[model samples]
Target: MNIFAKTGGNMTNRRDFLTGSAGLAGILFCGCGLPRAAHAAAAAPHRLPVTVAGKHVKTIDVHSHCLFHEANALMGDEAAKLTPPINGAQQAFMTVEDRARAMDAMAVDMEILSVNPFWYGKERDLAAKIVSINNDKLAALVASKPDRFGAFASLTLQDPALAVTELETAMKKQGLGGAAIGDQVAGSEFSDPKFDPVWAKAEELGAVLFIHPEGVPELNKRWAGNGWLLNTIGNPLATTIALNHLIFQGTLDKFPNLKVLAAHGGGYLASYAPRDDHACFVAPSACDPNIKLKKQPTEYLNQLHFDALVFTPEALRHLVAQVGASQIMLGSDCPYPWELHPVDAIMATDSLSDAQKHAILGGNAAKLFGLKGVG
Candidate 1:
């Protein structure tokens, strides 16, 4: 018998049991007066974790993508025209049951879902509507399966003021974990002071800002080829530029406590950080005195978080070495087949200890997302 049925009842669907008269709060907090067998069954093992210090370490994936069909439809045909076919392809349309199967195969207990930014080029009113639809759908998904999913609310960052209000609503009323933003807002870099208010609000709420690449448009001509460099090379390069601006422009220094998670293992920044640290020292004249920071450019990396989607054990090891283990989290960039074996990648790394592996797998993300029952 299933959990609800074992409690002297006969509810087969977990979603129904969660949303029924019993309510989610009662079911989650053991307020439904379930017997020991029911409680044990309800807390069934969702994942097999690596033991450390006699404790099982649950895995949480901080980088995963989901698309809401209704939200995509609301954007109109023009939105569809702009979106790449890969986005609406079969893997992208996976149902919750399908996703659960994938997660089980990956040994992932929980996933933080965020939609890649698509409406950045849309008009203000239309963009706002898209944001609403996306957030509403995301909120519903999280509410329905609180244990399996968490979310980073979508925002129309093209308008910072509206974005701030939406962020507040998503966090306060919708109970989302944070917001996901693109590498840049249209042509404006994230370092522009116009976005400071949004950054400030994120810091105030302790909401993590996930930076996912939207691809660099300026390099279209150069990136055209059979190799798909537009994605493999251009994506990370765009993220690198976005993050460098934040460092050079003093955005990170201003919002020192802001929680930022860079997708694709912080792009190319972690691998090439030392170059930035030495740039100023090598050429004092090129480094403007006014923009001088309290610490080296690479030093700011420790203040942020990165996902382990670098695709190689060596690269993952280098990222961890550059930024401490606590600053990295497991991310598969799922539904795209990027980092096909994220768990195995970490496991194969000879440089990391068992404890550090536990942290990168889920402990760090749990603390960052404020998720409970982890570590």
Candidate 2:
């Protein structure tokens, strides 16, 4: 039966009966009163089905990638310079089918896709076009499989103005979740005044800025040709460098409302926070002497949310102990060969209470992305 069917004027009686059967089916079915699009999203099958504390739970993954081909092509000379010639066909790399399968395997309800920021440091026109194509593709990905995916628009930080325009178009028009920017734009740091306009706009709109590493040029030269040096090590090294720069340089201080999410479990920041704090204390003459501080660098980490991608249960436990579970989100850096199983990893962690487990599994991201029921 199309259970929501109505007759004449007794619609309320019909819905009351339908709810009983729908509940038995374990589906949160909506009536004709709900929007058609909403109903469709609610019915999508790409969701990961989890049994948490006896209740079936679902999740939202905040950090997943898609569409590397466009970025690879746009990278040009930089592409050749890469250690292993960037693979245009990277796994889970942005086809609708691949995404659906991955979501099902990982039990991820939806993945918020971001364009790799590796495409950002090149020619302005090409970067803009690449952004446009990626946005269009992302929007189409969501529209086609609204239940499986959502997007955080990629921006060309090379031109801050263009970034603002793309942000508007992606958020307002396409209903994207947020924007993703590299840790730095080319040689310029994220805290530079040139990016203030972009930051201001993101704050005004309450947009999320997912920060990822693109191997800073100067840092790249230092790690030269060593396998696992640039990516496995240098990437996190770059993340720490950029984060410290943003903090000590007063970027976070100035833009208190700006929401920036860091990848790879916030890199080395999570582990070496005390050093950052100590440096601030002893060498008041070092970085920014005039900048007054109240808390340690780790305190800011609590304010920011991190993905549960640290891999080991012990690491996950340490993260939970350090930042609390509510601030940790589920991120399956899926398609990356080294990525961990998010649900299993969280389950293996003995440090978390049932409530904390609920939050790490899906509750945190649900609240962050405004999903109901779970939150």
Candidate 3:
């Protein structure tokens, strides 16, 4: 039977659900007669219930981002002194109410907020200050809407010692769920030995390290032309490189308990992981026996989490086949418009069972972030 047909004739395809057609407003506003915005305000930080196929599911978006206005101002001034000033008003920061309404439109129940890396190149003291400010703001925001938002703390990985201290403070004092990090720190890849302390700390704390892309600066010239390749290709390419380093260098082996969540569906690595296995078995010379992993490279994929932002049913299905449903979580890359219809994307997949869809939508993330009332 078609997945849409199983949904009791309420939703059909991703496009329709996103466009707010085909009884979408009714589905979104089922119990409440109020407008979506007003309903969201009444719910405040908690996700309003959404029913799919007569089953209520709480949608958690693990890949959404936010930019704290105060942190941006401080960093913006410092950035100006270091580089050529590009003049323009900053993109208006979305307020909490604005974000809540947007979430309602997307049918998302909760968001695990993270900020894109901006202080990776700052001096140690300056970077520490920025990390403090970002984490504090994120903590307060999540606290204000406990049901609606959770956050990954920011870290200054360029100085791993400071990163360790900051991570401790964020997790212990601020009660942040995890830390958000870029693919690389300055010129240092995450696989560098200098980061072992940070990794060890995360493993101990059981924190989820969200690896968002900072863009591959070396490829700027190639991505400069039309088509936005810098983001289209560069972003995933950066994540792919970072994960590869961690895999091949045995970072996952060293810290097996490290809970890492890769954005953009684990980039290109998850889909192409079999190649690593083949290279290790078929081409021994190409593989380093000295690295010494306890299991096959692909097996480590089960140990990690990925956001379902692949944008197509086929791609999402392939990722599940590669990683498994439990490892895949809903991630819209929210507020960026990269995925205007995330819930519909998963709901429309003919290949997934209702159980699988439920897990990807919110169950897995609820477990990962320790969210309540999602079961």
lDDT by residue (157-227, candidate 1, tens digit) is 99999999989888877768999999998899999999999999999999999999988999999988787
Task: Sort all candidates by lDDT, best to worst.
Answer: 1, 3, 2
Q: RMSD to the native, candidate 2? A: 11.6
Query: Once superposed on the true structure, which residue ranges of model 1 sit more than 4 Å away at CA?
Result: 1-54, 79-88
Ranking 2 against 3 by lDDT, winner? 3
Most accurate candidate by TM-score: 1
Models 1 onward score TM values of 0.85, 0.80, 0.83
Where is model 2 more than 4 Å wrong at Cα? 1-47, 68-94, 221-227
Report model 3's TM-score to 2 decimal places: 0.83
Query: How big is the positional error of residue 238 in model 1, measured in Å on the Cα after superposition?
Result: 0.7
Candidate order, TM-score descending: 1, 3, 2
Model 1 residue 116 lDDT score: 88
Clashes of 1: 0
Question: For residue 17, what is the lDDT in candidate 2?
Answer: 30
Task: State the displacement of the C-alpha of residue 343, model 1, in Å, after optimal TM-score superposition.
Answer: 1.0
Per the 3 Å backbone cut-off, how many clashing residue pairs does candidate 3 have? 1
- Model 3, 1-375: lDDT tens digits are 111110123222223333432221111100111133221222333235755567888898898876544455567656433221112113323346656777887778788888778888878888777677667666655555668878899998888988998888778766689999999999899999999999999999989999998778998999877778888899899999998889889999999889999999988998788888777677889877789888788888889899999988999999999999999999977555566557777877889998899889988998987776784
The better candidate by lDDT, 1 or 2, is 1
Task: Please give the range of 10 consecutive residues that has the lowest summed lDDT in model 1.
Answer: 26-35
TM-score of model number 1 = 0.85
> In candidate 2, where is summed lDDT lowest over 10 consecutive residues?
26-35
